[model samples]
Target: MLKPYQVYNTHSLSLCYNDYLLLQLLLCFWSSLFSLCLSLARNTKKILYLLQVAHKNSSMAKSICFCLQKLVFFILLSAIVSHARPPQVLPRQEPSYLKFVFNATDLPSEDYYDYIVVGGGTAGCPLAASLSHTFRVLLLERGGIAYGKANLMTQDGFLSTLVEVNAFDSPAQAFTSEDGVPNARGRVLGGSSAINAGFYSRADMDFYKNSGINWDLKLVNESYDWVERAIVFRPELKNWQSAVRDGLLEAGVDPYNGFSLDHIPGTKIGGSTFDSFGRRHSAADLLLYARAANIRVGVYASVERVLLASTTPFSGSRQSAIGVVFRDSNGRYHHAMVRRHGEVILSAGAIGSPQLLLLSGVGPRPQLSAWGIPVARHSPYVGQFLYDNPRNGISIVPSIPLEHSLIQVVGITEDGAYIEAASNIIPFASPARSVFIHTPSSPLYLTVATLMEKIVGPVSSGSLRLGSLDVRVNPIIRFNYFNNPVDVRRCVNGTRKLAGVLRSRSMEDFKFRDWFGNRDFRFVGPALPVNQTDEDQMADFCRRTVSTIWHYHGGCVVGKVVDGDFMVMGMNGLRVVDGSVFGVSPGTNPQATLMMMGRYVGMKIIRDRLRYS
Candidate 1:
């Protein structure tokens, strides 16, 4: 009934009216919501203020009663947020050689491999990658990848990972020796190298000579270069570290070797596995050298046993290793067969390698029979000759604070001791502290300067025996540290020598003093008793306090268990390239040496079997 212009105007007015109504409704809703929020916030502030005032003014019981409701609310809120949120989904760049197996279903259907390397650790990762250059290698790791572990990346997180009970099932498996020495090993891909203090130094040349194996020293040097280029970096010495270096130099550890990876007998700054930005570069990075198509890395694949075939080409009488049986993350067991002319190498570290060997019925015949396990080989020395590098240290709280540092300045002693110093920047909470109280207005901090002294080439030795048949359980280790008179003397001497370093002008500048449970007091080990003949007290301290730096070696000695080429003497197609095959401990942090051993053995296999067999 209306004209065209009137009709258009009417429609436009209706649309505008509807839009205006909607806008007004939204504004009203927002205004009410904002006011409610403001009221709630003010109430919250008042409640917090009341709680604080009551806590300060009232008795302890009254304060707790008043704050219980607020605490309960916050706890509930935190629980809701945590459980309501989805799990963190990590981004992936499709790996060529690496396959993260969450369960048995994730593994490939094929069961054959050219080489099976057990334990994707420092030695195993590089060894598998190197062998895969010419063979279809399978690297099985029991633990997950370390790329996104927040606990491993932070500064004080190392301590948290070490001390926290919740972290027992973490990649770093913590254990205590029968002697009550607390130690840990990496269940992760990088092994102990990933969890260690990160120092990277080649063994002293004497280590090679003492090893009794005909090591191609030239090739050893090349392997060192190969590893160092990938992971080693010269650490920047901080205030406390530099002061310790000066103290070492002043204490007659002469011939200052500046920023070198060579294991020299003097004050020197060594390389760390962490890069300049403090990011750790583990041996897992060495897998980059492999041709992706030739390698298959399965994380959380726990190798249970090495499969042996009756026919042996190398040794007519003995059985040959042709495959391995492992359990995936889902607890499903799978078998992997070795190809023709292929081998099974055990790079599962000192304790793990021997344990696996024993589990596979390749250890001492008597022990195997006692355990009711079928003996595959009568290798008597499979778990013998186990030794650990023992460390004794003194902790001091200086009048002035100390900077955080790892192993930096070391004083190699004539009496077979490697003395080093470390400090933590955070407040040194004593073990007795029931609670660490921190306030926003005045933050409390403490610094602990620890002088650690390790005995080089310790005479004390022990054994690693199978605790059970389960691969999940850790082996029982009995490291008889300070058992030998010579070892006790060296540890005592080492502590005394480090005490002298603390007495130097550089260390005295900070007024270094001992830390009681709660208070800091002046008590130096050397100055204790403040008189002559404190040797007895010092010796007692060494005996009671000596623990392992976790540099465990031997069990599968090169000459006794495996031959010079790292092959098992009585078996074929089975070799060990881990710290277990060491003829002797390299008398330093054994990470670099263990890596070199892996490389050397891989190269040997390439030359002896892959190329010329």
Candidate 2:
């Protein structure tokens, strides 16, 4: 132990000396290393923070770009799709007469045919064909064609469904009257000819003889063959075995002899044949043939009004037809001057023809005044003497089955005076519906029909007038359907007798229902729904419940309102051709009569008037 201060100084000096150059260098290096480490750690932390900021900015930029792209795509897609659509528009509700299956192309103003016939209906169909060969004819129809629609083309729709009636398929929102039935006209090209069941027969000859017209059975009989060939009328079944027929036979009813088997009477008896369309053909087929033969047709052009010639060409009467004013589907108005002095035949048919005449000032003056229509002339018989098939009907559940439900049976009055008796029977069957696929073989249901030819038919002729230039107003029809005592007696007896058949032990196998199926009249015609104690009570029911079977006729009777040859009597160049020519109801199905009228008038026009003119 040296002195304390001296020893410390010595120890310091010795330590300094003992620390070598390498050690000194190492210490310096270690101090630098620590400072460098601290700097690196701070720099690394700053670099990491900078990288995190870059990542956040980049992600935000990408999200902004994505949103902008989506907005652009949405705007472009919406604009493109909005520009695509079809050119033509179709009608929402079709016309009632569309069942007639008529179609036509746009008629050019360049078309200048000699004879222009209005309407393409039952009578008009054959008439068009007959005259087309000799003349340049133009047939104008107010409705579209039913070519592509299956229900009309193949007759797939049911015959008995109320769809066949004149009412709109949609129910009315507000009714205008107590008996607000929607009476209507056929709207398709062929008018009512397309959907009819083709029942064939003529009315009482007495009706024609008694009417002031110069008509007789001799003239009618002579023209029968010519008409049959055009229409092709023949019974689907020759020797029948239907229950209704059998029932009538059991009651001693004879085949309708007014003409004797109006359908295809055996050659030994008359020696003629016919086909499905009453006799041999349908109006649609006939008109199509005419079209193929190069006859021009125009459809969906409703004639707005007749544009008469400003100058007169007749004796105290202006030119019969100067030109016709009409309209197109676009609601644009148009006109067609009769082809260079060519005459127009007004076959607008029934309601249309009379309406046209009245609107043009050629009908009953007083009635026109009451309806607020300006009267052109005071022709008294314009809408007079309307007639239609007086349909007599009753339902029965048949005990027997028959092939081909349409026209499965027929019977006729045995005596000249059928007023005291109810004889003959015809039956129609409803189509097979439901998954059950029931056949006529089942004999489960049947409906029998009979017609009263002579009765108190339509008393007041209905008038079709325009409320405005374009709107068709409701027609005024006052028909006392079964007003005659004879009609009442016939129904009561028929119903009572038919009721007996259903009740008969023979018909025990069949089921029956009527009056909405409330009272079961099993077999025999249930006694008339009306109290049968007297005829007046029954007649009242007949008038109330009976709606038209849609066989309207005679409102525009040819001889009286027009002429014996169906020429508009007062006017020069127009004519009427349709069921409306009948003075009273035809005794049988109106199909044959209509065809005959068409054929007869067509031939007459071609032979006499055209040849002479």
Candidate 3:
């Protein structure tokens, strides 16, 4: 955790650059106004004599005062214009839909809901919204309300939100794995969607096939349309995004697959959650689809564990889940139950969902006993087989100012690796330097070009273990990235491919210049050392320098911890939805796929509830 001063210092550089420009310019007028006031004093005697003579005649006095006031107003206006600061776009204001939202402290009298959806995030928000149409639903989130922090989310501050020191107060909760990989998860109602780059793309066809579940492709397409209408947009490709697309084609990614959501081979442009005006539309926005009367959302409500009945409804199965125990903002605990034939759904993300199950005594018997948690069922795979789409990349500091753009083009390798590039377009001007130099020229924009790769589903595996029985304590996470030899080779090839693309003749127009005036440009991550040709060395470099692209799945996989319908293997009336149920990584940013899973699960539960009733 960073201290207050450290936090301030970390943000001060960018904050001052973005916010203090006007303040510095206004300060210059202080001295100028003092001299102007002295000059006005010399004319005071003459003005008073004119005023006294005019007072003898009322109309002349009124005319003279009006003229003097107008002249003074124009003079101030001119002075302000002359010292005006350079143009900078202001961050967007928060959305106005917060009036209908509620905090956990003010829950309704009804303790029973037709469906209890834990975690009001990317998956949970849409699932609750979808289920609300048919049954009364309860949605709970552990984070504070995100309604009033629009500027922090919608603007370029998305990156800052991830590194926020106050973990509980921030929308993003940062954590480091046992292997020392730094990662973060969204803690707000929108979940990770509130803090991500907003790139929207569906999973590849292989992802669905490998899941071993029968999905109606037509219904899946309909669900995609349902989400698209609310938040997805075709991003207008800027200069940087355009150059990346051309470069990928030049590197033989082949056949430009223009403007589509489907994960096709070759280079293609995808959708984004951010609109044309640069305002972010999070998954929480999809709550608009919910039936307001039947839906109740409670933010800052942390779920402790799933409550189970003393006996199972079935003759020989795990105990039936009845409700949940949660803590509110005031540190008050509450038990929220479900109506008869209703269900409890856990959409608390990859980490939270699995941890909840383990806390509820539904994990491996040996591990639960080791943690002193009473065992209700002996499901061995509650938090096993975790996968993080590890990404190895290169970043170049270009000499030319790059236009702002998120990921637009993606290259799908035959070996099942995904590659893409992105850059920040927000312009900046150094206020401190401008004040000292007395010049208002354009500041150098830090343009970053990255070539990132994600292995769709790798042979390597990791696990999440309980640090303690306490719900407040986070679980131990380890990605064990690149443990498989196959994964190592795929990353090596992908990294080389990205380097080739950058050196391609198509990228010749833009000079890849470093921020420092050196002929040698900067290469981010593990650079291919000069004349280093050993595959073993390249593999080692990747292992030490790899980072997650934030697409983590499994841990509570469908076939392992849950069934084909996403129901807990041993427990009745309990299901896990969210990325934790993903049998494999989606091969791209998993936001689109996660939302689709929420929609699918919501619809499935609705159908099952109606059939049973």
Candidate 4:
């Protein structure tokens, strides 16, 4: 694939750096000239004339000596420029495949690495990548390579098939308890981060600051930047629209005016634009860079419990976590012992992490008792506050076309995330932001919108329980979403606003209603926001219809269930470092927050490990 300039430079190997640089420049000019002439279909006569004109200029009284000096200079320049680039190394056997047979006994193999980070998806990937440099770290994942699979993880900015491929496909098929919350967790290598709509944003700073860590926006300022640097995640609403922006301004709900390229739903209500063509990347791509540097990763192994050296006392109820015991696909159980000199971090996501804790005998009494599981250490808070950001799709068959194209465009404002499609609206949000709105076009498609308010209050609490080692029972979720009269009122108002937008757009005026029209969401429900009094109607819509955006957080929290530093409050050597410790839902997407917590906890655990090392 070498260009003409590169070929010319390759021949100029005897020149100094400066001379070589100059040689390459001239060669580039000549190559460009030749290409331009060829592209223009210039004849041999025209090409000859062009060269003659240049030759005449360089001749300078037909002086051969001057021409020789110019030719030498060009060769020297080429040599230097070509040498400046790094030499491409040819392929060879990868170093990571080596088996260092030094651990005499089966003491977990001198794979007795300093750090063994489980789950290289999302938070785990970046955390492992960053820490691998400081120590011999092993990242364990359970999915395939994220990208390069056109069918599964495409490079184009589109939702990958990974999300749809969960442990269970349907709500009925998925395990559930009395609550009936279908567990739709991504079991892919990238985890949920691979299949999501590339939405990104921060939660309310005050929430994190108020949590037991005493972290305020100002104190965690560097933490935010650190996250951005580590990964390219940005706000969900990275950009905004003129109508949306002006509308928000008129409504006195403006945040800042910076814009972005993708559209994460429920990102505005006064802030920047959303990501338009969503960001879709596999965690494997990020970690592969580290893998090139001696880091190791394992896939397809189900981590069962953390292994601690205390038969006299179960580890969960007392000190910190040491290591882990996992069962491979072959049903063989193996333990990675961190008896000392290191640390074990639990990046087993919100849904998985809490379930892991409960299995390790560290949760509430009633739930564990029901499962015939003995409580190693009774921590009333374990798996007590299960939470997830709910989702609902409002569709309007658009008058215009709906092309699920990559390289998308989005607009932001004081409202939430907005897609440009005519009929369908996909927004990711929670009741916490209390944001809603509606903007309609010639609705062959629909233009659903939002203006959210802070929704996740403390009054609504839930619990996560284990049905078996492989299954998490129906999580006892009690969001009390409609409990807030104000929230209900906002939903009603949002509906009204949507109606208004639909009324004003071309579809109505142009009589495109036959295709774009929608039957208003009025049904048999108590919680319907009819004067915010009909709680039944709204509750019906909330219950039967809404799906989770998968932003689960705070079930196995640090302060309530876990400890101040993320160690399961009563557990020894075990720490949960995923999106399950939000203390309170931040009313935004939890991917960025999950990553932050992962990196934060990963480093902290490593710091402690080094302290002991």
| Model 4 lDDT per residue over 489-545, tens place | 444444433333333322232122211233232111122244433556654554455
Q: Write the per-residue lDDT of candidate 2 for residues 296-348, one digit (tens) a residue.
A: 55666677566555355345643466567666666666566666556666666
Question: How well is each residue in 390-508 modelled by candidate 3, as lDDT tens digits?
Answer: 87776654445555556777887777767787764322335355432344553423344555666767778898989877666678999888889889988877776676677676566
Residue runs of model 4 more than 4 Å from their true location after superposition: 1-111, 151-163, 166-183, 216-223, 226-256, 260-279, 282-294, 311-320, 369-374, 405-459, 471-490, 493-544, 606-613
Q: Mind giving the per-residue lDDT tens digits that candidate 1 earns over 206-303?
A: 88988868989888988888888877888888777898889888878877989878788888898888766556677887877777777777777788
Among residues 3 or more apart in sequence or in different chains, the pairs in candidate 1 whose N, CA or C atoms overlap within 3 Å are none
* C-alpha root-mean-square deviation, each candidate: 16.2, 34.9, 15.2, 21.1
Top candidate by TM-score: 3
**C-alpha lDDT values of all predictions:** 0.72, 0.48, 0.74, 0.46
Check candidate 3 and list the clashing pairs.
Answer: 404-425
Error of 4 at 104 (Å): 21
Can you rank all candidates by TM-score, best first? Answer: 3, 1, 2, 4
- Kindly indicate the candidate among 2 and 3 with the higher lDDT: 3
Candidate topping lDDT: 3
Clashes of 4: 91
